[model samples]
Target: MAISLHWLIALLIFAGWGLGFYMHDLPLSPAKLRYYSWHKWMGVTTFILAFLRAGWLATHPAPRLPRVIPPWQTRTARITHFVLYLLMFLIPLSGWLMSSAKGVPTVYFGVLPLPDLIGKDKALGDFLVQVHKWLAFGLAALVGLHIAAAMKHHFMDRDGLMGRMVPFLKSPRL
Candidate 1:
């Protein structure tokens, strides 16, 4: 369940990020509106998956770092993970709030409408646009860091840390 949620959320985040960058500057039209709707749908789905992932983590817990890893790397990994989880929630909420402020409603998969987080305010909406954008970029960077750390463990350390989540990649030397 944890691994499944991890991959699913990862896919959604990347797709949403790609669509966000693609749709940001297009002239207002039906295609742009459709893309925005799709992006919001992905964000909402990611938000829901993040909650499930957190709940799963609370019950199951992440594996401890390999003892051979330096304490600094361990601390950095933990801090980065916490912040990644935080951005998983914050980015989606910011987008939802921004939509509300812009007088646009988020309809989950074009069906159920989520309640607005705040009353309409153009200035606040403008502010939240930046907030969401920067938060997503932060997420992107951390994701890169996460992947790099995994690769370092798998290839250099041969510690099987990557196998903690992805069993097929467990190093034979472990």
Candidate 2:
């Protein structure tokens, strides 16, 4: 369940990121409006999934670091994971805030109309656009780091660490 949620959220985030970049350059038109709606929908889904993932993690703790791994490495992993979770929650929220401030209603699936977090203000919306963009970049970098670390553990360290999330890589070596 945890791994499923993790991958689902990751997929949505990356998809949204790509869609956002593509849509950003497009001129005002029906296509752009449609893309924006899709992007907002993805953001809302990711936000909800993050909450479920967090709740699952809180109730069911993640696996412990192997003693073979250095203490500092373990600490760094913990910190990175904490921040990643934080970003998962924050990025979508920032987007919602940006939409709200820009006077755009975020209708989840074109059916549910979410209330604005704050009153419409162009200046604040502009600021939040920057905030959301930077937060996305930050999350992307961290995701890269995470993948690198996982590969290191799988190949270099040969610890089968990723096996926790990937069933085929079950950790007999551990």
Candidate 3:
């Protein structure tokens, strides 16, 4: 369940990020509006998935790192994971708040309408737009670091950490 949710959320985040960059420069039109709506829906879904993943984590604590892993590296990994989770929640939330401040209602998949969290305020909306953009870039950077660390463990360190998340792959030689 954890692995499935991890990949699903990862896929959604990448797709949403790609769409966000693509639509940013486009002139205001129906297509842009449609893209924004889809992006907003994706953000909402990502937020919910992040919440569910956190609940799962709370119940099922992650396995401990191998004793051979230096204590500092373990600490860094823990911190990185925590920040990643934090960004996962914050990115979408800022986007939602920004939309609310912009006086735009977020309709979930065109079915359910979510209420604005704050009253319309153009200045606040503009601020949140920057916040959301920066948070997303931070997330992208962290994800790159996370992947790099995983690959370093798998290929360079010959650790089985990657295989644990990817069951089909054989554990690397220790």
Per-candidate Cα lDDT values, in order, are 0.94, 0.94, 0.95
Instruction: Write down the TM-score of every candidate.
Output: 0.96, 0.96, 0.97
TM-score ranking, best first? 3, 1, 2
Q: Write the per-residue lDDT of candidate 3 for residues 56-101, one digit (tens) a residue.
A: 9999988889998999999999999999999999999999999999
Per-residue lDDT of model 2, residues 8-63, tens digit only: 99899899999999999899999999999999999999999999999999999988
| Model 3 stretches with alpha carbons more than 4 Å out | 172-174
Give the C-alpha lDDT of model 2: 0.94
Q: List clash counts for every candidate, in order.
A: 0, 0, 0
Clashes of 1: 0
Q: What ranking of all candidate models by lDDT puts the best one first?
A: 3, 1, 2
| Candidate 1 segments exceeding 4 Å error | 172-174
RMSD to true structure for each model, in Å: 1.4, 1.9, 1.2
